[model samples]
Target: MAGNPVVTDWTTDFDHTDKAWAADPYPIMDELRDTCPVAHSDRFGGAWLPTRHEDVSAIANDTEHFTSRSIVVSEHRPPMELAPEGIAPPISSDPPFHAQARRMLLPVFSPQTIDKLEPSTRAYCQELLAALQGKDVVDAAADYAAHIPVRVIANMLGLPEEDGDKFRGFVLHVLEGVALPLEERIVGFQQLFEYLMPQINDRVANPKDDLISFLLASELDGKPLDPFHVVRTVALLLIAGIDTTWSAIGASIWHLAKSPTDLKRLVNEPELMPTAIEELLRAYAPVTMARLVKEDFEFQGCPMKAEDWVLLSFPAANRDPAFFENPDEVILDRSPNRHAAFGLGIHRCAGSHLARMEMRVALEEWVKVYPDFSLEDAGAVRWSGGQVRGPRVLPIQVGP
Candidate 1:
């Protein structure tokens, strides 16, 4: 096993294993971007740092050169070899297969399709907010932001709303481990696989209006999708959709609550909701990293080898001086933002449209009712680890 990377300079500082930096990595990232854009880190298992917008975007967009074969940097590899991420090959083999699967999943999350769900999405957001109406202090991440995305995804996947809490527990447990104890995580994954198998079987037996049902009924290349593929695809969606969006929403709310000026601006002008979402995503860069490697050659003048893990730093990219005029500030109406928060190229997040809608609805409705909310204890905000980045606890006091 390899060891974590080391940073010897003030410009390049990070303890990849440090819990504090995970809570708010921008400061360290800024240091790195200013001094060492391509600095190497031994703390993160020996991956080079690419903090500038151009370097990160170049690596992400040129998938053929820097393949998406190992999206996570954990010490151990996942059991499911063809798990629809982190490997490149023939469509039936890896990269191509992921592309095809994405095409099939796109319709379920298309802007048009997601727009149709706006009423239900907004209603749910209001309902969740209503539950928090009288509370003096609440952990917004747990009590509100995290729950909405999972519930929405559950409904979309034909799961019961009551199971949302349980599913979230499983997701947090699986993702939090830096080096997931293989046996325990494997057992957990197996249980999840077992839990979803019957659901897929039922969907196959009797199709409905949900995603699993659509997967079961649809044909890939003249034949029905393999049942295992459907399960893997749904599993990916559940993990990615629930965790990433939940974190993004939590981070957005945390930032806004911390800034009364920004909150006041948005509350006074509802039209800024959409731009606010982008700015928040850019400022926060919630998703940790996407792992990939070169298929044949080198990157940034470094000698390349097949399957060598590299981290694509989206948060760093979002703050690159070349991309945004003032990378650190929250410009709500940041026009031509063109960020890689949802990633870039073919594998960009399939659920981005829905994610935007969810955030927009949550912000539009939450600010309307809780415009006066303020952080209960600003220093109390904590973040959890995993492929996702977000506040673990965001306590706030809401009132008129």
Candidate 2:
């Protein structure tokens, strides 16, 4: 019970099931890093929170010591398995094997691929921003952040851009674990599968020039991928699409709304947007990943038990004082940023390129059209709770 006193602090302790942590976790995260760098919790059948930057990087990269078989920390629900094989490949998979799936998918979104797609991406941003013109208020999360990735990912998957809203619902329900029971979230996954089953099957029968069709045509060891494998990959793609950048964009806007000086700098200095975004990525870093302990190993002085959940708080890692100078402050053009917002190791976020592009465009366009804006109502602004974090309802006062 040595760790209990600090763990029971209640004010700073973190548990995924606790609604309080979701609202504002930074204070508790600060407490953990300062006091218990490697803290334990009883909520999810005993999970470890690695608060320091080096600890997170070490755990995430050491495949021999930790496994990516499961990343979600839940007492009742095991981590969702990826399809293509026993592994989810790249994201939820260990090295070597993860590379197999990753290699094939990389060319799809390679620099060359995205270069060709940039014009369309720009068009989408303009179109979305144009719709909000003349409006006094904006739901940055839903109106701007939510719609861009939904449409972009939809277009990548060959789904209609109009279906973006429907995709947003599934992503919010399943990944965010927002206002719904665990069972309901499971059903949401099924709903997406059922919804896409016919299209996936159709792609198999009559191959098209899209991601699904491309996956269907792909061969491993000269054999076509299994249907389950393909569907699981699609599920990962769907859930991953909207929320990550949605959080980054919402958090960035929220920061600017709270900081008029920073907002003004970017609005006037467009060239600084790139590095400024990097700084924001570090400060508002989202997405915490879990690695299943492969064996009973003493990791950085902490005894990690086998199969126990060891969550790498990339967000916390980004805020580490040792790793970053003035870790709390968001310095525009913060250089030498080695944050793990995208993640570390072979499972580093596959969509990092798309995410940056989406975010840059989102912020660049917003600042161009709107002047310095502030939170419409500070009390009503809401953030999402779950592994992937973001503001679900971001109301900003942009117009007079």
lDDT of 1 by residue, 23-108 (tens): 66678778777777765544334456677888887877775766555566655543346434433221112465666666777788
Candidate 2 residue-wise lDDT, 1-400, digit = tens: 0111223453234565445556777777788888888887655566788888988998888889887776665553354454224334556666666778788788887777877777787788888889998988899887988878887888888877777778877776666553355676568767988978887988888887899898888876578887767877777787786888889988999999889999998888889988998899989886888887877889777777877788788988998999999899999988888878989887788888888888888888788787679999888888876687778888999988
Instruction: Give candidate 2 misplaced runs (Cα > 4 Å).
Output: 1-13, 76-87, 178-182
TM-score of 1: 0.91
TM-score of each: 0.91, 0.92
lDDT of each: 0.74, 0.78
